[model samples]
Target: MNERDVPGWKNCDTMSGTTAGTTAVGTSGTQALDTREPGAGFGEMTRRWRDLTGESVPLPAFSAGTRAGLRGRFQATRLSDTLVVDFAADSAFRTAGTPVAGEDVVRLWIVRRGQWALGNSRTDNETTVSAGGFMLRHVGRLTHFATPPRTVAQVFVLPRTLMRERTVTGPAGTAELRLLVAHARMVRRTLSGLGPAGVEAARGTLLELARAVAGRRFDDQEPLLASPLAQAAKDLAAARLSDPDLSAAGLARELRVSLRTLQRAFSAQGESVTGHLREQRLEAARAALLTAAPGWSIADVAAHWQFADASHFSRAFRARYALTPTEYLRQQRELRAR
Candidate 1:
């Protein structure tokens, strides 16, 4: 749809489809995309955000010299299908994003580092978002937001193809939406510390959170877990390495696939259910030994990976790494110290 047809067709620049003019100068793969430059990088920031969201983002003169001395960075990382972006503008600036076309996505905008002067084009109403407050923006609407100098904000853009559209100002179930938004913010904030632990579970949980925030009345949360069921099952098992209650049957039940279906999936990969669990457990345990906290006892490591005891964990670790768990941790620590 065009800008005027959008729900809150703000008097902002109409966002078009992805622009092909900007260069890809940030991190490759799924790490993060950042724009860091001298003076105002408004043009670059706009392009970088467009590349991630596949929408046009235009910049407005919000500072005395927004097109001159504006300096800062914008960073974006992809987790599963979601795009998490953090933008810091050292200069005062405004973002006039045109209404996103043909996509019914929702962007969770969290004001993490600055105060924002937000404008709604549809109602000609303006609001302020201080630090720690967040709002949701429908992709198919006009967008206008301005920040004073030295501002930072984060956006968690999630596709909402699975849920009904909610109005920007008056979505139903406000309390539930608040809880889900807070949970999503926390996930993106501490994801690095999680160190790949429970990534699959986290991804699945995010799907649920997004649906909840979108005010969907469905019980199934798999609109985004469209990956191979077998691989998804394996990821779930890996995420639960420390739970001790994760088993083939439990995994099947959790993943909503029958035990027979799971068995058939494993057979297709030429692996037994037993062998798959062992390898996942062993790999998780080994990874933990490498980066685990200093005070983590051997038993702690073992229990985290669901091993029966320290001896079993050590034996399994040695079998895979050709070194005892203690030896591996010590050697790695000494190397780091050196």
Candidate 2:
């Protein structure tokens, strides 16, 4: 399919052909397809996705009409000889195919956003995964999937030989799955900066976590070793610091960890969840103060960063940086002038 047939992607480049082979060798690292670029379209995205991951999407479900801003990001990271992590989001598509010979891999598709309808052509049975749910299948056989628009998902591709069972699926409520997702995120986020040894270590940690999720093995301490839940919390908090309701309990709930577990994770790193969150907010506010528009006020910056009020913001800012917001702003301006 070409760009003309796909709305919202009219500016993207067009190309043709289907059928991709997942012939990654000698540490292929990562392959990516981002349709958000200028002059980029699903035609090229599909071809690239097919070529990299050996999955084919000949027809995306846009016939009935789709949202105009149809953009997407896909990445397949080969973490080890036995493990590959595939992530895709903000796209509507369908994938149906039997593997080429020797394509012996098991795939676990975890849905983070919209629903996924997965079917087995042979059995004619289907499984639907809602947000926070997961479906696992052995890709050595026929499997099909339909993803809804604006879907966010991740697929953990493992060699079939690694799994003791043929299928591994789980509900949205599983703590194990949540922890696995956390670990996967940690590994993916840190992979680029890691040395060869660090990457291998992360790969092994994630693979073990995946095995535990598949019910192959388990150790109570395995999850903790696999993920820096505190770091993940910090990353998430930094992004959502503007929300006044964001707190340790909310963060723990979102991360699928107990309040105690969240506290322990932070304590292990010599910090408290609320304290770290506050520090991050203050830092963000400080940066904003430096570049804020002339009309922006101290109270505006304080409110934007979720401080209770300008007075509370000033007290906290003074305690942390030894200067009130007003003083810090003036000091920065004076420094710039000098």
Candidate 3:
């Protein structure tokens, strides 16, 4: 297929002669899943996926009675700054981020088959969504989702700039998700068929659709942050863990409240906003260190969480956990070995 034929992508190349090899960020066309045979080189494809998306997607464990291998046939097409990809996996797996950079894709997925149990960063909660469903995630957020065998999903990897500019993005509440999933399927279909210019022209519609999924309620209004202002503040702090400018004052501005009001709110909950944000950042860095990949460095994790530097991050971590980041990571590795 020619370059113009593929939507949202240019200069496409495939690592294989056929559908089963490592495909690049663009697709030739909608490639079908190769259920006839187990896909080869799952490890390489998954690593490429890591490079493409800046996510560390761990390979799934094989379930009883299910065969293994990368049965996932995923194809990508870039539309302007956004990437529209379709994934169909024959085995169940979980995915999470190990960010080299602080930013994560704000992915909007339309579930066509099977189910996914999504984990949230702001809270210790999992939302199980199935076919005819959609999920909207924030930048830098971590999630774990399991795919059933023969599962098919269409995902729109939206640009964070578009989200930050056109919409007030946040977590999707249960009440609004049903409405969103229905609307996204329609939008996903419309996007799939559109050419580059057509896709560009429809940017307004897509942004509105995304805004709906992220923050809007069933009434199509942006859902108000849950009360008990301290909790809401904490949630925002956790969500924006990587932003260096995410101070108490900035948090107040985002919340549209005065700085004093924001401080007072957190004080009511027995903590200061500034203190809380600092702790959240330190904690985020600590967690990142525990799961840091082989090639990652202490400096990378520090910068990712917007810490002053490696030394500052280390000091804070050691103060909190009584162990340096390296020591803590070593302990975690030893614990896993047992």
Instruction: Mark the regions of model 3 whose C-alpha exceeds 4 Å error after superposition.
Output: 1-28, 32-39, 43-68, 96-101, 120-125, 141-143, 162-199, 215-338
Q: lDDT per prediction?
A: 0.55, 0.63, 0.54
lDDT of 2 by residue, 180-286 (tens): 66666665555545655665666676666667677733454444542456666766687798988899999788766678878887877788988998899999999
lDDT of prediction 3: 0.54
Better of 1 and 2 by TM-score: 2
| Superposed Cα deviation of residue 269, candidate 1 (Å) | 9.8
Ranking by lDDT: 2, 1, 3
Which regions of candidate 1 deviate over 4 angstroms? Answer: 1-55, 65-71, 75-107, 110-117, 121-134, 139-143, 146-165, 168-213, 217-284, 287-297, 303-306, 319-323, 326-338
lDDT, candidate 3, 36-151, per-residue tens: 24332434454555433333322333332332333455665443345556677655655432222344556676677886665542133366557776666653434445577767
Q: Judge candidate 3 at residue 22 and give its lDDT.
A: 26
Question: Which lDDT tens digits does candidate 1 get at residues 38-103?
Answer: 332446545544554443232333333454444555555444456656666555665533443444
What TM-score does candidate 3 get on C-alpha atoms? Answer: 0.39
Q: State residue 8's C-alpha deviation in candidate 1, in Å.
A: 34
Write out the backbone clash pairs for model 3.
8-78, 8-79
- Angstrom error of the Cα, residue 188, model 2: value is 2.6
TM-score of each predicted structure versus truth:
0.46, 0.64, 0.39
